[model samples]
Target: QWDKPLTSKVTSYLEDAKEFVPFKLKEVESAELINKNNIKTVEWVEAASDEEEALPDTSHRQEVTITFIDNSMLSGTLVSDTPRELSRLSDCLNTKESFIHITNGERHIHVNKNMLLRVTGS
Candidate 1:
């Protein structure tokens, strides 16, 4: 029951929003309140794509493992297409948004940069 179109990307939905948002968990079968600080990583298994034009040009895909303050790890692929995101993964991580979006095949993960202690590439 979101106001936005189904085609909108999760990254876009999270951008410029409030500190907390409603997130549905299929495993638990309920929507939970998610704050930027509390969320270490939001992962989507077999994630679907939105509109192609809304997505990055995606010339490169690199695998990255992120470690949080609590020592939890979530590994996913980081895609870079634009010039700003092209130079390095850190550049992409430095976006205005608090979440860093990464993908691997059908898997997509958004890591909270603020909660991350380190990010290693593989």
Candidate 2:
């Protein structure tokens, strides 16, 4: 499992490509490396390097609840290499990015940054 080495790309809001889908290097580069099309936003998900391990490390992940502009809520994990405070998190959100990737184990969800109201960690 996870031996083929693949990346996931969501083509539309309702359509999602499987993480194990085989894609040509050019397609991966075009969709992931460079946003040439400008129509789709690609997020890369790397396979867990340690295949023998049953659980992946969660030390660098933060449990977060994201509130949207419409008052909707989403709970997921925010992966960060270094420790982060609320102030730092707020600053990053102020940059007006296009999407925020919320990962949950082997899956992830991309939320439009413009639609987010705030992110709270626990």
Candidate 3:
């Protein structure tokens, strides 16, 4: 009996199914609003560890030429004796206000604690 075809009942069943599933656009808009505010904050916290590992090690000292914004140059062995002094000098070099350019010119280079000692050594 269930397998028998019913042409009159088919139309009524299709109409009822269509009425039950209604489209709501407001739900999609609310979801987008919530995601936009929360995603950036989550990404920033996740990236913090990678940022710390990328930092350079300034414990070891090396010879570098210090170039002032005025175009003057100073060549000396970078004194990394203390962490504070090394940090201060590194900040100065990294800044656009004062910079360091490493090079060897005809003039002799010198390294001193308080002053720059440069001579041709004639």
Candidate 4:
């Protein structure tokens, strides 16, 4: 870890690096043991794309209630480029990616599928 610390999301660890590939190298498991994680979820307070919001008809947003594996629950909105892009709530959960994007106003919360028990009502 750098002496000068900075917060990062799932990716974007090296803020200044030009060519950054997440998990490009094989890291030792012991490194994680040294780093105690208090991270429950990775939530980003950021702006949504200008174009997406500008075209209201083209934008697809869905509200969902998630129950985590730990039995904690939350409600969030999922926004996508188009409904066909991710047609249904089930499709979002079944996507190849491990993380699903849920928006809370300007905030984007990427929840890991591994931590989910059941996700409903989107």
Candidate 5:
């Protein structure tokens, strides 16, 4: 991570890199962000009533739940003031994109928006 803002561009990690792994959202079935214990099962809540305004913002990292089109959900933490392009679930939920990038600690995941259902935070 650089000191300045990092946009959600297809990066090869090297500035002068000629080729990078193209992200084909349509072809991707599922992806996972490497975690400490590699736990993939996240408890799916049928209905979460925690309002965004009701949640305290004192904590830099807020708990978030991302529900996909298949009804499967992933519970993770997100930075309070994340960038716009990467802040779909935080800054503004109105802007729907083709993917949802989530950062949980050192883990980073990009969930295809076509398959994304809802993003709930608390």
Candidate 6:
């Protein structure tokens, strides 16, 4: 009878559904899995070349006033023969700090090494 075959098909469908339940539970447990000891550790590395080139020595020593765009001034001894770099500006003026002050009439402002105008003998 057609009714007998329909009942057999429904029974096989329930058996397949039962097999899928364990697979769904395994997927949920796998999603919650964690491993704590797999973290990466970093180590510090030293440079291969430790020696650097020495700076050039200069003899033209004189007091120089550097003026910024805002008319601030800085007076310091100027040493030539050194390369014109931002970091070397402090050493060229023989100053320990990064900035210097220059005066423009009644107002005074701070200037960096790149604002130099001329170097005259003190």
TM-score of every candidate: 0.67, 0.44, 0.21, 0.55, 0.40, 0.24
Least well predicted 10-residue stretch by lDDT in candidate 1: 47-56
Q: Pick the lDDT winner.
A: 1
The worst-scoring run of ten residues by lDDT in candidate 4 lies at 30-39
Model 2 steric clash pairs: none
- Report the lDDT of model 4 for residue 93: 66
Q: Quantify how close model 4 is to the true structure by its C-alpha RMSD in Å.
A: 9.2
- What are the runs in model 5 whose C-alpha is more than 4 Å off? 1-61, 79-91
Off by over 4 Å in 2: 1-60, 80-87
After superposing candidate 6, which stretches have Cα over 4 Å from the reference? Answer: 1-58, 82-121
Model 6 lDDT on a 0 to 1 scale:
0.36
TM-score of 5: 0.40
In angstroms, how far off is 122's CA in candidate 2? 1.3
Q: Model 3: how large is the Cα RMSD against the reference?
A: 29.8
Worst 10 residues of 6 by lDDT: 36-45
How do the residues 17-59 of candidate 2 rate in per-residue lDDT, one tens digit apiece? 3223333475455433332223222344545762443223532
lDDT of candidates 1 onward, in order: 0.67, 0.51, 0.31, 0.57, 0.45, 0.36
**How many backbone overlaps does candidate 5 show?**
0
Clashes of 6: 1
Q: Write the per-residue lDDT of candidate 5 for residues 1-122, one digit (tens) a residue.
A: 45322322311122223323222346787653333222223222222332222223442455778887778987776443345355554454433333334555445554544555677888
Report how far residue 41 has shifted in candidate 1, in Å: 2.0
Top candidate by TM-score? 1
In candidate 1 the C-alpha lDDT for residue 34 amounts to 77
Predicted structure 2: lDDT: 0.51
C-alpha root-mean-square deviation, each candidate = 4.2, 9.3, 29.8, 9.2, 12.6, 32.7
Query: What would the per-residue lDDT of candidate 6 be over residues 1-122, giving only the tens digit for each residue?
Result: 23343222332333232322211245464543222122111112223331131112433333556554456545544444434453354455565432333323332233333444443344
